[model samples]
Target: MKIGIEGQRLFRKNKHGMDFVTLELIHGLQQIDRRNEYVIFIQPDSDICIEEIANFKIQAFSSLAYPAWEQWALPRIAAKERVDILHCTSNTAPIWSSIPQILTLHDVIFLEKPQTTGSSKNWYQRFGNQYRKAIVPTVAQRCQMIITVSNYEREQILKTLPLPQGKLKVVYNGVSRRFKQIQNKRELINIKEKYRLPKKFILFLGNTDLKKNLKGVLLAYSIFVENSETVIQLVIVDLKQKYLSEVLKELNLPGLQEHIVLPGYIPNRDLPAVYNLSDLFLYPSLRESFGLPVLEAMACGVPVIASNTSSMPEVAGDAALLVDPKDALLLANDIGAMLSHNNLRQRMIRKGFRQAERFSWQNTAEQVLQIYENTSKSRVTRMAA
Candidate 1:
């Protein structure tokens, strides 16, 4: 089968969750399936991480904008390449494409009401949300199959979009092997020195997104600091200092900034080390389809404290402490408890390792490949009939 995978942002440096998911999916497919021909369509950029192999080929397309690229360029290329299936890895896909398109609609968060208005998110985020909100429903209708990461997201999609019963598929996201516990003292020290990390800290991977609940995390950390006898720093990755300052002022926790460490964007390769160094990991998002970071942290042998809402409990699955994201006091108390109790922390770490072992890219890839094969066979059978 000739498969065209939409990996528009794959080649870019500093990838986010969706980009890593797509990248890992491609790598998994590459390792498992050599008979099936694959074409990975991506917007031209510098990262060039994936190399062309025997069955897998990298195809780059240059376009002025994301919508134009997906709408105009991607479909034309896929048709020209005569791909049997075009899998849009991201949430949005080409609406006009006649190809048997498969869309990985990560979540329908964009379609929901704005969690925060005004400057919570920048112009780029606002525009992207609006674009997805407009296009996802139409694209979801046209696509051959809609793949969501978690069961919670599957229900959300079912409720939000009017679709046939079997049109949607649920495939769990996998944690990469890179996120294993770091044993080497030298490597940990290098990463620590590289980021100038604190001696001890709680890690919260967040951005300016309102759903990330950065404000709540900051407030909770403030509460944790105020209540606890020992002061442990909070390390937040990929957040801008200027934005952090603004948020600090807004929360009236200007003193909180000193207690917080912003090491900016840590590369994906180095994340495992950061996870190892962290005393505890926080994933208190308001909502998530699949909390990849939760698993990633767990894989690195860190006890996690995640929000109880949405798919978090589904993903966490008793391996991590779950608390309501909205309740800053509760979150802070949990953080304190998790830190103070050695036995509880050790139990969580052990459970986390077991939980992380359950999900793997190979399994995810196999499931996806099965879907592709089924779709192809069904198409051929229809034609024969």
Candidate 2:
């Protein structure tokens, strides 16, 4: 099979859940499907991060056009490459491309709730919304097959568009095995020294989107500081310091200084150590499709306390301490409980590893291959008839 996998997501830095889903899935695809002729379509200046994967080929398109290029230029190149299929790892796909596509929809947060309406609104315009409006539903309807990270997201797609039940496929996101099996002690010390991290700290990673419920995290952290005897610091990684400071003021945290730490975007390679060194992982997101860090924390054997909404309950399973994102008290209490109880923390680690085991890129890719073959055969049978 000649496949062209989109390489844009790997270039996205300081990205949260969906980006990781895309990057890791590409790695997994290469690992499992080496027999297939694969060509990764990257924008210029990608630098080819993963040198170890020798099975496939890497080619570049114009980085300047970037986002719009996927729809504009990549499709023509994909046809030239004679790609039997185009797996759009990112949600965006070419509207006019006749090539069969395997488009991955990580979540439908924007379509379900236009986040830019209320006080939660971040900016006047978000990237790719305009492109995605035409790209997503069109691909969901027009593509040979659709891939969603969660069953919850699949159901949401059904609600959003009238794609048939058989058209969609569910492939859970994978946790890097390194996260589950790592000796980050030296690295953790290095991270602490490098970042000047606190001794006892709560951790939150990823973008501070409206659904991420960072406001709830800040409020709960404030309550934790107020009620707990010990001073537990809260460290948020991968958001703009300016944005975080504004969030602090927004949540009235400037007055409560020294409780919060806003260190901007850490490299993905460095996150395992960060997860290992932390006291607990608090994810108070309003909703998440897969909840990547929750799995990352579990893989690092760190106990997790996450919001009980969206696919989180399904993703976290029994591995995490679920809390109501809106309830500051519940969030704070759960955070404290995870910190205080060693046995409970250990139990979470075991459960988390088990949950993390249930997903792997290899398994996900194999399932996708099956879907491709099934979809391809279906199209052929219909065409012949």
Cα-lDDT of candidate 1: 0.92
128 Cα displacement, candidate 2 (Å): 2.5
lDDT per residue for candidate 2 within 156-262, as digits (tens), equals 88888888898788888877876755564687789888887898788987464677787788888888888888888888886677777787887777855577776
Q: Give per-model TM-scores.
A: 0.98, 0.92
Candidate 1 per-residue C-alpha lDDT over 261-366 given as tens digits, one digit per residue, 9 for 90 to 100: 8999998999999999999999999888999999999999999999899999999999999998899999999999999999999999999999999999999999
Question: Least lDDT summed over 10 consecutive residues: which range in candidate 1?
Answer: 112-121
Q: Which residue pairs clash in candidate 2?
A: none
TM-score of 2: 0.92
